[model samples]
Target: MAFIGASRGAAQGRSASALAARLGFRIGLVGLFSGTLLLAALLLFSLQPMFTKRVLPILGGTPAVWSVAMVVFQALLLAGYAYAHALTRWLQPRAALATHVLVLLAGVVFLPVGMAKGFGAPPAEGEALWLIGLFLASIGLPFFALSASAPLLQAWFARSGDARSADPYFLYRASNIGSFAALLAYPLLIEPLLGLDAQARLWSLGYAAMTCAVVACGLRLRNAAPVAAPVEAELTVEASPRRRLAWIGLSAVPSALLVAATAHISTDVAAIPLIWVVPLALYLVSFILAFRPAQPGPDRTGRLLSGLQIAGTGCAFAVVVFKQTPFLLDLGLTLGLLFVNALMAHRAVYALRPPAARLTEFYLCTSFGGMCGGIFAALVAPHLFSGVYEYPLLLAAALLCRPGVTAGGLPAVLREARRSAVPLIGAFLAALLALVARGPQLGIEVLMVCLVLTLAADWRSPARASLVGIAIGVACLALQAAVMAEGGNHRSFFGVHRVYTSPDGQFRLLVHGTTIHGAMRLRDDEGRASTGRPVPATYFAPGGPLSDVFEISRRVNGAIPAVSVVGLGAGSLACHARVGEAWTFYEIDPVVIRLAQDANTFHFLSECAPDARVVQGDARLTLSGRTEQARVLVVDAFSSDAIPIHLLTREALAIDFAHLDAQGLLAFHISNRDFSLSHVLARLAAERDLTLLQRLDPPRQPSVGFAHSPSEVVLMSRDPAVVREAKAMGWRAVTPDLSRRPWSDDYANALEAMRDRWRELLTSAR
Candidate 1:
């Protein structure tokens, strides 16, 4: 009966619709993986960002915090993979399952997700390691257990001997699908529906559900009768080292391509900063295409994919040469290239996959390489190369990649180059483009010369082609960025910030990462400043939440309230000081302070308040250490694309409550294109015992509102009267009660809250 059943299953797979059914199931199963992976990713992705934000106000808004968080995540993933490998090897399946469940239960005990208060403060130079170690102890175990699901499940599927016709790797397609959804859902659904508190609960609930499912899966498999392989499983010992290395290369090539795609897209137009997701999204899609148990045969697709990769590389180089963003074009071409390269790489992996007995080892290499790639791009590259030139050079290298099978006995590059010389020269001739921002004539002339020489050499030899491509990258970097580093530009680990003094000379502007945090007008800073008036700019616009707080402070007597700002971007808020107003800034990045102050762009100290105190470290960390009573406190940390969910929790808000005077107003910038932060604030307001009023007035102009990352702003206060006062001072209440639960230190999952509404949000008004 079992042999007949197996034959039926195998026959079903070979039928026309069998592949479709398998592919469909694989794509949809991704949703489940999305749910499973959420907890770990939340710890790695959300918590790190959250902790960094909580501490950013103190660290001076330095990019280093983000960098450090990445290091932690990569290390933890590596550790998790190692643990999964060990568990599958040593423990019997049931024992492994029991251990995972118990570990997960233990992780929940660390609950109410948050770093210890004041952990954000800059540690003594010698204490950084200890600091990180403590943080890992606090959040690491739960994350580690959760991160192991994919590998653990694969190992189980391998051992169970079920779905003999189905590829264990098809499950990975679903896993990545889950990963992409989490990445997308956090910004779109999770943040807006549930405040950090409720979000945490929802995430915790999902974790519970996943745990149950895992337990159920384990229970079902334990009692199932075992089936024999068709005598094939026993023969599949580990392949030779050469073959293993080939698999690693297959995985690594796509990873390298992903990093290159990230760099290419960034270089084309680093302004709005199209992040790494598009490349990664396509990379995930390749699994969907490549991993079916019985995929349609490779038809002409392999050659097509190879052609597109070469073309994509050439086009990417062209954009760099021409100096045009061609935003949509770049996105389309890069995505196309990513898809093709990923498909080819995945197919190669598919062909190379060992039998079910060795499935775990196969995926171990893949995930390890993924973790390695992330470290390379996020950790190593920043330290290794000062610029993104490695991106294009890598793209050039990707074009040369042929399958290992094709690598042997290919037409000699020398012969091919000699035959194709004319076309190569012509193609190079067209690629020499220079921007009008710099003198177009001299730039174009210089590029034309380089292009001709490059084509000539590329047509003759592959090595020469690679060398010429590197030269072009070097030249492009020099022209686009290298020549003008000291003036107007601030290059830091976070991203580039450009300082341009307004043409009128009335307003000095300060830009950081990608947004303008502060601005100062000459009228406010120069002659009028001595007259004892506070200047308003950026967040302090009359209709903005921060400005509403300042307006409420007008009635309070005595030395104008000492205002503490967490994020100091060009010290634009310094211009808002009143006659005796003492403003202390908690800026995270030293580069930000230097650029804002030394550049003389927005003279917060020199022009507005020279004696203002500037404290450095995470704001909450700094605030947690102090007992100052400010009438108004402003938290505007979500200006970057990176949102730290931990900062918006009920617990953290309660800490804010402690530092505020009875009438103190806390202006939270809830404006975000992706998240409904006002809702998060509302949830926190209720949970932390605070009265909250929210304003949804987006600046008429795109650039006028709160820090740029968030699209809207809200002000929360412990006192309802304080909120009411801010309302009278121009604060608009968009949501009296947004009806979403708050995200807490314990659990949060934005994907569940607003997942349904995201598609519309993407298509709707700004």
Candidate 2:
């Protein structure tokens, strides 16, 4: 009996050992797949900001650069998804693994990513296409490999015979979490801590590690069992065309909104990674939440969707109508609207997601949708609309994605509408008030009422919801028309440029976004439009620092024979030219050049310096190769309130100094509402041991005629005579802070500049 008991115990011990080994192997497989996906996603997202920053200086640092970059990213993502789907569907498991591993090995050759060497400078026209080509040549293969990993690995995991392999869709949540972390880390840690070269090398190391993980996953797949018969049967049930179309629609709206939101905030504020990342980070977060297994129930989902839609509509109305809003509030409202809409749309997509058997095909369709949306926003919209009308138009379209929009069809919509008559009547009354009031504040109030009525009318009826969307769209269109009617709106690859006369009739302004680029004096003391000689008003007004800088140059070096101006804003500074002085203007935007040179618009360029030379393309590229020297080089370029960061770097200063004579002066117009750049210049000057002269010139007088803006000008020169003369004329010698690092082509911190500006403002207020 004792011998029999020992035999039973040994059998039990063998059974337990087998069970423990199986559990350990399963855990190891899960970790391999999950870790591979996480690392690939991290590399994919971090590459965007790093590469875009490298290309930023080639073009001027316009917000459109980031927009175009997003299109390229989406297009490649679609291609990668298609590759994964085709490989999995047509090839056997071993063949597919071999193909992918080969692709990964090829991608390694393009490591330590940067732009291709042969593309010297972006063309003046078709810059979007040029940028796409640049990206394709530089990081195309590596990015393609990274983008494929999420979908391909999930498919592999499904065939691994693990308990969870039947539902590999959960892996998507892991992918997006990595994406979210990457975007957050870029602006907060990577950008602040490392230069572009260092970032590229580190990313390459991570890529190598991810490649090893992928190989391990393939080895595991070799020994795993085939997909279960039930799963294969599920795969044979193909997704219908209508269902695929639904997936496309659900994916496109949020993708388009992501780019639009990025442009909206970055255009007026600053075109830096910090601002660009916010919308993208929120986009990933939406995906994470949408794909989670624990979702709100039917009733709770309805309430959440309704509340977010209402709030988003109101915020959109306020932002589209009103041009000037407080910075923080404007940014907050835009980002909030983005998150609300994206989450709603993504939830709808998640609801319609297919089983894991069709995972790669589902991802392919969604990626195609994303690419289409990006194309519309980045390539089509710039030429299609005079303003950013796509923004409001997309907002209206997103209402179509709301739950139950097609539930009852037209008849049910009619019934719901009849039931909602009271709210509809109230909304109509509010609309009439908005039309009559024509005030921005009252218009927003009316918008909120209409949106509430629209949402509450029939949450499930497309017809009813669309009616409300159209009404709000028309109202927004009319408001935009009113604003544009006052100006000549010109759309360009750079941004929207508006030329108009001020309401006070004292100035003809050149505006971009919300900031006035240049203002030309329209009226003289006698209240008549000044016609004979163009007057340089605004930042370049008489007795201003710009004028003083020119005057001091003349006093020290006698006749100033040649000058070069980097930014051609209405060419107002051309009036500062004396007879026989050769002036050359470098302007990146053709629209601005056309307006400035049109004698009918402003006579500054046409009348003042008709013979001045005009060069097209980015100043960094166009200005760097010049061999001629100038007596004064005025770096006064700006896009709205934000200056191109490339123009403020140490390398840019070297380019400026190279083009200046030994006794010449370097003058920078550093007047900005969002950044404090004088300290940057001071640091650069100290680095080169050059004398720095800075002046904060307030308006000389407030009057009905031409008035000057408070200009902050910084001048750097090695000549003692120029320095002495500048000081005598109210320019102070600024002491540089050695602790603050100066900006360079490889590294810059726009976020720090913003912080310093706000700190200065708060201190002054105190």
Best by TM-score: 2
Off by over 4 Å in 2: 295-302, 406-466, 524-527, 699-706
lDDT, candidate 1, 606-687, per-residue tens: 6677878877655666777777777667776543434445566666677777877765667776544344555556666766
Show where candidate 1 strays beyond 4 Å. Answer: 1-245, 253-282, 293-300, 303-341, 354-360, 385-478, 483-495, 499-509, 518-552, 555-559, 599-602, 641-654, 662-735, 738-766
- Give the TM-score of each candidate: 0.66, 0.94
lDDT of 2 at 227: 81
Q: Which digits, one per residue and each the tens of the lDDT, describe model 2 over residues 246-265?
A: 78887888899899889978
RMSD, one per candidate, in order:
8.9, 2.8
